[model samples]
Target: MYSTRSSKILFFHITIISLFSFSIVKPIQAEPYGMAGCGLGSMVPVWKNDIGQVLAATTNVSFSSQTFGITSGTSNCTNDGIVKQKMAQEVFIAYNEGPLELETTKGSGERIRAMASLLGCPTHANELGKLMKEKHSYLFAKSNLENEFRSKEILVRLKSQIALDDSLKYICKN
Candidate 1:
């Protein structure tokens, strides 16, 4: 028989392990899938239900087709989508930080035009440039300047400002 102290210690260990496991659990994604996501297993019509997740998982593990699909952009896997678009926007902003700053301050530039295109507002580039010019200080606040994710912060602020503007909100796709 275990001592009372040993029992308490075991309970504590189990509690901590359970908490850690919950913390590491991924949130459900937008796309519907069983335990196995976007692969040959997911494509199998008979095993589409929640209860069939075990079979799907087994199939995915057995074939390793998910890895191939993600890499090759096949089997319902996407190479370009919302996530990639956001990353591309962040990267573009980071690379053109100096140019964008100058263009925004002046309310126009080729870089600003390119940014508008990236944002899915190519036709409204002039309006976007004007908005950016107006919110230049807000978009590049000193606090934001010191951030590690400055580009992302800038994009957020820019989108926020566009949303606030009646004219831009309807025109900008993003």
Candidate 2:
């Protein structure tokens, strides 16, 4: 039979071990829409916190122009490049709204193609889509999306990747 002292010692050891183990385990969190889609990447040249502020001002001004155009019964949306850009925005929005993984699967095909089209790379869309698929993890999943530092790290890495490729380099500027 175990003595009371031994039992208490065992209980203490188990408690200590449990606490130590729990402290080391971290949950795998899903990254936010920013990293999952190129939301954060787009802000590049601009950091994370400022991206929203800048976007807010730009959106307001852009909306004012759009509204004026609408009231005047003119929409540049019908223009060739503008039409493709609208399609690209739809894809980008869909990526931000949908599950993170969906960005990898569906996006690698249509979304990338849309982006390429918007960037005037229609002929190279398929190739770009294939490359985006191949690089999805580094481009999306590798970072803890909630951490701006980590997001920026991956974004820089992604930027370098884009910079290195002629077909994808132009997006780095935008």
lDDT on C-alpha atoms for all candidate structures: 0.77, 0.48
- Candidate 2 yields a Cα-based lDDT of 0.48
For model 2, how big is the CA root-mean-square deviation?
20.1
Which runs of model 1 end up more than 4 angstroms from their true locations?
A: 1-83, 144-148
**Candidate 2 at 130: error in angstroms?**
1.6
lDDT of 1: 0.77
Instruction: Please give the lDDT score at residue 14 for candidate 2.
Output: 100
Model 2, position 126, has a per-residue lDDT of: 65
TM-score, candidate 2, is 0.35
- Point to the candidate with the largest TM-score: 1
Clash count in backbone of candidate 1: 0
Across 116-164, the per-residue lDDT of candidate 2 in tens digits comes to: 5544566666665666567777666554454435434544554466677
**lDDT of residue 122 for candidate 2:** 65
